[model samples]
Target: MDALLTVVVPVYAVEGFLETCLDSVRAGLTAEENAAVEIIAVDDASPDGCGALLDAYAARHGGLRVLHLSSNVGLGPARNAGLAEATGRYVWFVDSDDRLPPGSVRAVLQRLRSSVPDVLLVDHLREHPDGRLEQDASSPLLAGPATLDRLLGLQHTAWNRITRRGLLTEHGLRFPAGWYEDVPFSNPVLVAAGHVEVLNRVCYHYRIGRPGAITATRSERHFEAFAQYDELYQRLDRLGAPAAVRSRVFTLMINHLLVVAGNDSRMHPSCRRRFFRGIVGQYRRHRPAGHRVPAGPAGLKHRLVAANSYPLYSALRAAYRLAAARHRATERPPAVSPDLSATPRPVQTTSLR
Candidate 1:
């Protein structure tokens, strides 16, 4: 039988969590659904025994397909490899370190079979190091008159969303081979899609604060997010997007700047001066004229960055860090893992941009 759904998992050095993630995937699908599902796990040259583990599971499962990369190609390329091999009607991207909630696969398959949408969006539950699982907060875009506006406003993570395989292939949309690649691809896909379904249910369980997770660590590559924003805006412009779309794109540009400049605490100290300079330049290049100034702490940071005031921006970032620390301190320590259904996922996504 033709597969109804294909789950693409890009595996790296996730030996500790790989088994749990796979187990969750296996349990999430019903026996019938399992027969109609294909799990494409691309082992990205993990130095650990993850490749072997995946092979062992593939040996036991009929629908499990494992692809091995000779060398590390990062997350984007690894996903690309899986995408190339996928043959299901719908495609869902899941991180190797994350898992799906019980019955999620069956639920997703039922939805797609009933009425296929160009894209389907679901919520996520985040497991924190402090042993708390929280449901992700809902975005206004999820409940709106579905339009390009809503899609642009949605988070850029590949998870928590499923797209019709044809939609992606027809548009020739693929992740870029670098950090923050999701931005350009995800934004354009949402805009290009004709129909989108937003389900408020929590389908994916995301783990946060994992030591060695790409997002938990900071690097100069964080700057790539700004480049992605530029590419997204350029693509929208080339596609002749309307004023409303352009306006939202401008807002995204500002948000990306703030995230890279003010939010990234792991950024190298030497890169701060250069990063701030790039932020100011991007702000000038993209800020929409006559746009109402954003209000709130974020608005303040935006203005500071736009002003190109190094001292003030630095101070504001320091204060933001302190506030975040104090907030964390108030939460319970890492005692026991919270039930996956307890609280909602934290707003933090792989794409902080």
Candidate 2:
């Protein structure tokens, strides 16, 4: 029988985290549940020992399958290769650096059996470097509505959504190569999905600030975000998505580009001006009619981009950073406090005087 779910993990230089990731999928699954799910790990020509490790793990686990590629094709294409071989009703592209939480597989299976949605969106926790786990802020939105605008507002990650294979194949929806691949792939899936459901349970644990992680690394490749958004806009146009949906996507595109522009870790220092220029061009090209920018600092950023005022934006960013530093300093608690017990008494000062 064909499996119900296919979990495609694209492995690169993540040997350190691969075992935990693989184990998490099978951690709490019963034999029948395990049999009903397929796990595919693609060895994307990683320079590290990931390939050998995958082979060893697959040898030990009868159900695990590993696909070895001759060349490194980045994360998007590696996932595509695994999807091509998937034999499950639904497909999930999971990153090797991340892991599913305990009972996550069971939750997903239960949902799939009951709902059979074209797209099943689940919640996730973001694991920070300091060992903190925080639920995604938009988790509540999942239960409210399954509209494309609401789906777009949620986190734009492939791993959070388990999609019906037929929906993807019918729409020719595949991840494109390059950075910000999720932008193009995730949005289009949400737009194309006819029946969507949300699983409010936290199914995945995403690690943040990991060393050598793409989001934490500084590179000019981040500029690929522009091209990816361009592809997404074109796809939406072809799909004849509603005007509101397009406008929402345009807002999200500007917000994402601004985030990349502001992030010190992702955007190189030298590329700041050029990146701002890219943002300005995108704003002019994609900004919808009568679109309302978000409120507060974010809204201000949208206005700045619309006006093409990079210099003012730079100055405001600097001032905001300075004020934030000061605010943090003020909010810090005292390192040490006076101990009243350790202090000497007045010692009958009145009598002594």
Q: Which residue pairs overlap in candidate 2's backbone?
A: none
Span of ten consecutive residues with least summed lDDT in model 2: 344-353
Clash count per candidate: 7, 0
- Model 2 spans > 4 angstroms off: 327-353
Best candidate (score: lDDT):
2
lDDT per residue (tens digit) for residues 175-268 in model 2: 9999988988887887887777777667788899999987899999999999998998888887777888888988888887888898899988
* Cα lDDT tens digits for candidate 1, 1-353: 76888899999989988877777777855678788888899999999999999999888765689999999998989999999999898889899988887767776776677657777777676777754776454354555555566556766788867988898888777787778878877777677677777665567778988987757777888888778778877766755666776777777767766666654554667888788888888888877677655689867877877788888888877888899899898985443333433223222211111
The Cα local distance difference test for each model comes to: 0.76, 0.84
